[model samples]
Target: MPRRLIIDLMRASCDVPFVSLARTLNIRPLLEARGAAASPPGFAAVFVKAFALVARDEPTLRTLYVKWPWPAFYELPRNIAMVATARVEDGEPCVLPQRVGDPDRLTLAEVDAIIRWGKEAPADQVPAFRKMLLTTRLPWPLRRLAWWVGLSFGRQRANWFGNFAVTGVSAYGGGELHALSPGPYILSFDVAKPDGTIGAMIRWDHRVTDAALIARTFARLEEVLNGEIAAEIRASRASEPKPVRAIGA
Candidate 1:
């Protein structure tokens, strides 16, 4: 069964706009195909790579919006960082691999390696992962207190921890096309369809990014995915053929 903790956390604080964005992307068919595949590693790698490439091309895609009483601000970053939670065994607690970035630069082999490593990391790391997972474990009042503390020190320390958060549902048979939540920084994508068509849903912090900027970023990403990146992948595959051994006389 899914963790009750996670479920409750989501119920209490779920972003309805984010969910709506997912629904708009129309990723069901793609997710269905992915789920049916015997091996999904390649697909997952491709999706991650695509996201990375898109982020690279459109730096704003990696940014977050921060709202202040007077005005809102934007934060620009170089990479799209995300977290992945993996369960090592049935009924075992999930371990989170934090801040996997630049998925586009990683080859399928590399992605597979990382997944393997993430799942098998030392037991000691598990506790840290759990802590991150249970960040919502704090009572609402305590959470507010921490946020206040974080904000109080952030200006002087140049650290703003709650800039943004992104969660991936593709691994769970959720359809292609990522979704973003409106915040300092939040984005998600649905699984890709078998036909190579993808829908991208973006939620931006209105305070930081206007609709025009978000649209521009999305358009650039579409071009990258459908044009150069897609072409490159196809070319790479086409250049390689299965090797056969010659029969000895």
Candidate 2:
């Protein structure tokens, strides 16, 4: 069925104890610099790298809780982003995650290229889609069993599903109050207001952390966006070739 994969994904997401924390961020500086870039990167790419940078310094954001093999926390060595991307399957629109590992270590252009690949490439060509499709085509009982085994094992879970997700409906002109994912952390953001503030929410597995840490993470996200992310945009603009002057003005 076209919807079977999404159904299984939701089923697994339901098992996690997710909690959300929302904040209004002022990122006018980054937004302005991005608007001025010769070729601006997508907001999804911007948010992905910004969050990964923050997670790089905060171990809690990169930690996950493992159920089977005894309940315990699993902390990844680097940030793996599972970014939700839209695709059409058999005349039906479906969303699949594009995994970008160690995004914090990559440039904004590199991250954008990977996200664009997930969007434009055929489903079979994308590793996440290939894996999900193959599993979805399996018999119902076996499909469910695969999800259980993958989710129960900490290392396998991280490799297959990733540790954090970045998703939003803002491009559709609205914010997502809550987005579901199988990762330990999920970040959703809305369009900016006239005052240049945007509503951002971070829904995380409470089993791994609490509100206080998320609150602090938000502050760091703002800083990274304005500091590192914004700098990248400006740098890109500066690196663009200057226009040739006319013989006579």
Candidate 3:
């Protein structure tokens, strides 16, 4: 038998409530080979950007619910994204947080690049990851205090955790319909079929919004992925280089 060293759970320990939801979009006909020589953004970036863009019109998903001191909902201006990224740490595979602010305005290529840099860079060099490391290094009790203060009061929550989070399960080769997150909106992207159909799952804090808003988000997501986003990706083909796969890609 081997003795194991137990570690404190950092972000996972936060007591946030979320309502699980899922939407299946039929993107089959959208990918009918237009002879695109360039590679498109990874599924994760596509979903993240799509959500941010959709949020511009809806605005409901952009609101966060803060409890403690005084219960309230806060609306954020920029669509900051907290993407779950896998990186190498201490010669082992570890998942860290990679934040992309203003993802709504950034092109798909740019968003893809930032996420790639987070995955490729060392944990100490990446600011988001460095902060995560520092917070987790604290004793569990202190860590809880910090999370409580940062997440429940002022603009620290959006600054620290971003407006929303994204995680993917399809890279593991299964079409998952849910992933855990502790914020207003966390999206889980499933596998894409050759026909272009993909599964999208959302976990949202219903205190600020509801299932109706998420349903609209799903519709807008499919719209951008197959419409405007698709056009942008096609345009990138003229100067496209090698593909940059996201973490777990």
lDDT of 2 by residue, 1-249 (tens): 447877888889998889999999999999899779889998899999999999898888889899878999999998889998987877788788899989999999999999999988988999877888898899988988998888999888998788899988887896656988888999999987878788999999988898999999999999999999999999989999999988975
TM-score for each of the candidates: 0.58, 0.96, 0.86
Q: How close is candidate 3 to the true structure, as a TM-score?
A: 0.86
lDDT of 1 by residue, 52-170 (tens): 67666665555543323333344444444443446654656753533444456766456555555556775336543444345545776775565444333423111322333444566
Ranking by lDDT: 2, 3, 1
- Model 3 agreement with the true structure over 1-249: per-residue lDDT tens digits: 000111332344246677888878876534542236355677678778888888877667778777657888788877889898876567766677688999989988899988998989867788887776787677778877876777776388888777788888677895775555556788887787775677778888767877887887788788877787777767777665666888983
lDDT of 3: 0.74
Candidate 3 — which pairs collide? none
Top-scoring candidate (lDDT): 2
Deviation (Å) of 7 in candidate 2 = 0.3
Candidate 1, position 45, lDDT: 51
